[model samples]
Target: MKHRFSRMGVRGRLLLAVLATVAVALIVMTVAFNYLLSVSFRSDADDRLRNLALDESSRISISNGRVTLPQPTGEIQEFGTQIWVFVSGATVSSPNVEPNLQAAAKSLDGQPAQYLDVPEQEVRLYGVPLYYEEERIGTIVSGLWMGSYNYNLRMTLLATGALALVLLLVLGFVGRWVLNAAFRPVSRMTAEAEAWSIADLDRRFEMGEPHDEVTQLASTLDGMLDRLAAGLRRERRFSAEVSHQLRTPLAKIKAEAELALRRERNPAYYQEALASVSQSADQMTRTVEALMAAAQEEGSLARGRASVWQVLEEASASVGVLAGENGVRVRVEPPLRSLYIGVERDIALQIIQPVVENACRFARSTVILGAGRNGKEVVFTVEDDGAGVTEEEKDRIFEPGVRGSAAEAAEAGGATSRGAGLGLSLARRLARAASGDVEVTAGRIGARFVVRLPTG
Candidate 1:
């Protein structure tokens, strides 16, 4: 049942919900009205019967210790036609009055007012006592038949029920029509969304300004589409960049391999060619790995927010491990105020960790991490007290496969450079994905890498 209900469209559900509420209210009112009307009609009938009995009783005269009721004629004749009157030994019955009700009325002479049942009808009987001084002379008993009252009330209730049923049917259809009209905007949006394709990511609902719920919904869907378009574009750019960057290394590997295979050579010559091939493959691998991370953002930058200090702390811990292994000290300077950014902590760490680790890997003694709020951006700094970038190398330092001055220095000094120049490239792409960037400048003591991201 629940599943069937869930399967119903919004229009059907809305119509049913409204109709059901109105139907329940109508039923309650009908029942209560029937009760109130029935009570009033029966009471009126009882009063009419009692008044007739009183008039007849007043007309009677007592002479010489004998009671004489008026004859069933004149004004009494009309009244007697709708009531049952029993006075002493004389009795009068209404037309078609039940013998059972007459007998029940006689029995109620000394009792309180009560109802007597006859077949499918009822009679309300009221008894009055007549007395001479302290002695009881006679009893006046009267009753009104309730069959007509019951019939009229039953007909009224039946008509009320029929009217309610008609209203439910009418309103059910009308409500459905109204609801469908109201949701027409949503239907249009659904159709438009269904027609959308990945190839047409730029096509948007573009609901200009949010006014109502439907407009708000359209605007939200457009926002989601915007994110999807941005992500797809980013992925495409990353793929293109990866292909472009990997081509040279792949060509080098192919040329070297083909050249070495062209003729037989000594072991030392073959070993040199194999090492060159291995280096090219390693460079290509690094490029692919970095580009893949840049491509697979998972909508994290668009949907997440975290404290800037927390991200710095976590990034510092991650870089600290690599720093300790390299005999370099990592120091994080506390910010003056708590700052939050639009990027998630893990993603911020992803973007910052690479740059910080690169600094720690190249640092002579210590690397300092610091952060501060600058206008609408959260700026992060990673400074290494090591050989800084030369004026010529700073221009193309963030480019993929550029392996700048630090890598050059490490290579010249016979130290292992941890990356194939993709770390800074990946870091810059990550920062830009979050509406920020990574830039390098000559610090007072060493090289400084600055990352700026949107503040929350």
Candidate 2:
């Protein structure tokens, strides 16, 4: 039974529940109506019988403890009531009393004043003892035929049952209609959401501010779709960035391998070729790891704490060779107070190294790295005393494959920029992956880049 109920559709189940509730209420009402009707009929019969007995007794007179019967004034009938009198071995009754009814009335002799049912004769009898000066006298019994009352009660019961059944049927139909009307929008929304999920993730319900359950549901589904669309965009961007960044190293490795295999060479020459291939392979590996790490969503990234100073020092040291080769001085300034960031040491270092490398590559004399706290974030500032980034290129330089005008000019003049224009993009991606950001800001005399991470 439980499984069968569970197998029903929601609409069917709701309809059944409503019908069951109405059925129970109808049953209670029908039973109560019939009971009250029966009581009303019985109460009328009892009142008639009682009134008849009392009136007949009042007309009688007693003399010296002997009962005196009153003359029959009229056809002593009211609501088909009958009366019987017994005194000193004599019996007197209303006109046309049947033998069975007389016998049924006699059975009430010497009994207290109360009502009794004589089902065989369809009569209800009530007995009252006549009294004079507290002396024993006689008894009066009144009976009322129950046939009409029983018939009316039966008719009322039938009518009530038929009406209740009709009401239940009507309510069942109305309840089904109401449930369908209520669930119609839900069904349509579910189907549309399923279709949109498969074919058009960008589609949204776009319902206005929520004022009801259905509208609230639409709002929630819209939010979910937005997140799914965002994740898909991120995946596509990650793929494109990886391919663009890894292509050069992969081609270099392939060229070296092909050249080394073309001819037999001295050990040193072959060793040099293998070493170049190895270096390219290493570069490819780093490129892949950095892209993979940056591609992760912040919620899925492994969380750890890293000292702000430690990560800054490590990022600066990693680009020491580039700074020395470029004749640039790299300086790390300690924070006013020790601070921590919410990302792991390695990931934090990865996030800052690219910006530092960019600074070292473009600096003329000095590159400064410093850390400070801002609200609930740890901010690192990297400044380089070189041709400052133009306002137009500051944001554009972070796009993959976009090079600043200075870097482009230096490359055209045969001066190495030592970058393929992916460093800043990777830096920004990794920082965002850790729930942080990297952005360029206006500097007093050079280019300034700000990296912000949540404080640990």
Candidate 3:
């Protein structure tokens, strides 16, 4: 039974559980009612037979050891309604009386009232001892037949059981139907999910205004699909961007190799060709690494605590040569508490160096790198004295391949577009990967890039 129940689906199990409860209730009620009915029947029979015996005994008289027996009444002549047998030693009231009744009367051992089973029938009876001046003369016993009452009880029980079973069966099916109706939304959700493919993620289970469990589940599934669709889009965009960025260096390398292979070249020519190829190869490698770092939406800097001030010092030192060559003075501010954030030292440098390099390339004089603790976060700022970004371009500064008007103007002046506009974008990505982020805030001077990471 346990295995059978376990094999059934949820609907089947629920239906069977309800039916089983109904069956138990019906059985209990039937048994209790039958017991009460039987008790009532026995009580009625006892009362009737007890009264009849006393009345009939009064009709007979006995004096001086000679008994005067009255003729049995017309009511007593009816066989099953009443029966009487006078007890005097071994003599019964009538010779032709039922032997079962005679036997029952003879063996009366003086109980107030009880049932006695005859050979072919059952009877409820009472024994009354006749008395003359407190001296026992004989015993008069009376009984009523229980065959008709028992027959009626059997018919009643059969009908009651049949009706109960019919009602339970009807209700069980109806309950299953009701449960199916209640779970219709879930059924629709399953069907929709089965029909969907990865390309169809935009289609949502738009169950209107979630007011119930089924609708709420549909809403949750829709939300999950939304996230999945967004992730897929990001992945596709990353691939396209990486391919576009790698093409330039690959073409450069191919052109250099073809020029070198066009004719027999001197050793110096071969050396320059190899050197050109190597530079292009390095450029391609850098481009790949930058794209990869930028595409990493979830950074791996969620562990390892390091001092923010120390990270700032290392980042400034790494880019110190570029700062000097670009004529941009770099300033590093010592934080008040040596605040620590959840990232490694190199990752911290990776996030900071790009923004600082971008700063130095376009800076008029000096770029300031500052760090401090803000609540549970470590906030770092890189502010430059270059031509600051216009309000209209502030939002576009960190977009991939989107150069700010000031950076474009700087490039127009032959100050090289250091790192192809991806540096700041990649900086933000790498910062975000560490459970941190960089944003362009309004700066009175040049663009102010603020980086915030969670304090460990």
Candidate 4:
């Protein structure tokens, strides 16, 4: 039964529940009404029988223990009351009464005042005793036929039953209409939400402030869609950034391979080409690993702790080759106190290495890498003694494919700028994924990039 009920749609279940409650109430009301009506009919019959008996008793005359009844008067005849008088071992009754009822009245010959029923004759009888100066003379009995009352009561019962059924049907239709009207908005909203989720996640119900259940539901769904759309956007941006970052090294690797295959070169020349290919492969590996770590962080996967000092040392070492080629001295200034950050060792290295490499690319002579504690975060600052970033370019420099004046100047001066301007963007993105941020701060004589990560 429960399973079958559960299988019903929401509207069906609600309607069934409403109908059941109303049905119970209707049944109770019908029973109570009929019971009260029956009581009223019975009370009326009893009162009529009692009054008739009293009137007949007053007309009786008891002389020397003999009871006499007057001939039927106008009032008694018009009222159609049956009267019976029993005196001195004899019974006298009104004419035309059924034999069963006459016998019933005779049975009350010596009885005191009382009421009784003759069901077989549909009659109620009340008997009153007549006394003559403390001596019992006779008894007078009055009867009221209950045929008309019983017929009226039966008709009432039928009428009430029919009315109750009609009311039930009417309520069923009204209740069904009310439920449909109420659920219509919900159905439409649900359909719209499903369609939006599949095709247009940016679309929203745009209903104003929530003041009711329907509005509240719409608000909740809108919030969920917003989060989903943001996540999708982040995923797409990450893919594009990763592909862009890998292109430089991938092209370098391809160029080296093609050059090596183009000529029958000496062993030393081939070795140098293979070395270049190997370096590009290593760069590609680092780019992929860093992006994958950022992805894992965004997905809320498990993250490990790394020593701040160790990460700085690793970042400096990773870009040591670039710094040497560019005649830049990369210096790591150790913190006075031991510190750890809430990120994996490789992820921390990836986050800081890009900034250090960028500094090496544009540094005049010295690039300083340092770590310090900042409230609840570990802050790493990389400063390069080169053409400093203009105030207007600080934020734009971190945008993908957007380079600062320093890189464009180097390129215009016929100096090779190894960076494609994606490093800072990728670094900032990774830092944010780990609940941190990278920003370029105003420096005295160089561009100071700050990376902040949560403390372990």
- Reference-based lDDT, residue 237, model 1: 59
Q: What stretches of model 3 exceed 4 Å from their correct place? A: 1-7, 57-70, 73-79, 85-87, 90-97, 109-114, 203-241, 261-265, 291-456
lDDT per residue (tens digit) for residues 1-456 in model 1: 889889999877778789889999999988999999988997787778668667767776778866665444322224433444444545543344456655765676655455544444455566766566666655666655566777899999999999889988998878888898889888888898888888998898876899988889888888988898988977765665666555546666777788788998899998998987887677567556645655665334544688887877767755544676679988889899999888766567667877887898788899999999999999999999988888887759787778776777778889875566766776787788878989989997999999999988
Candidate 2 error regions (>4 Å)? 61-79, 204-236, 258-269, 295-427, 431-456
Candidate scoring better on TM-score of 1 and 3: 3
Identify the runs in model 4 with alpha carbons over 4 angstroms from their true place: 1-4, 73-80, 111-114, 119-121, 203-238, 297-425, 432-456
Least accurate stretch of 10 residues (summed lDDT) in model 2? 70-79
Off by over 4 Å in 1: 1-3, 73-98, 113-123, 132-135, 207-219, 254-279, 289-456
TM-score of each: 0.56, 0.65, 0.61, 0.68
Model 1 CA lDDT for position 152: 96
The true-versus-predicted C-alpha distance at residue 21 of model 1, in Å, is: 3.6
Which consecutive 10 residues in model 1 have the weakest lDDT in total? 72-81
Shift in Å, residue 153, candidate 4: 2.2
* Candidate that scores best on lDDT: 4
- Candidate 3 or 1, higher lDDT: 3
User: Residue 430, candidate 2: how far off, in angstroms?
Assistant: 3.8
Local lDDT at 31 for model 4? 90
For candidate 3, give the lDDT of residue 352: 78
lDDT per residue for candidate 3 within 284-360, as digits (tens), equals 67656655655663556566778888878766755555676678899998887758888766567667777777787
Ranking by lDDT: 4, 2, 3, 1
* TM-score (C-alpha, index-matched) for candidate 3: 0.61
Itemize residue pairs with steric clashes in candidate 2. Answer: none
Backbone clashes per model, in order? 0, 0, 1, 0
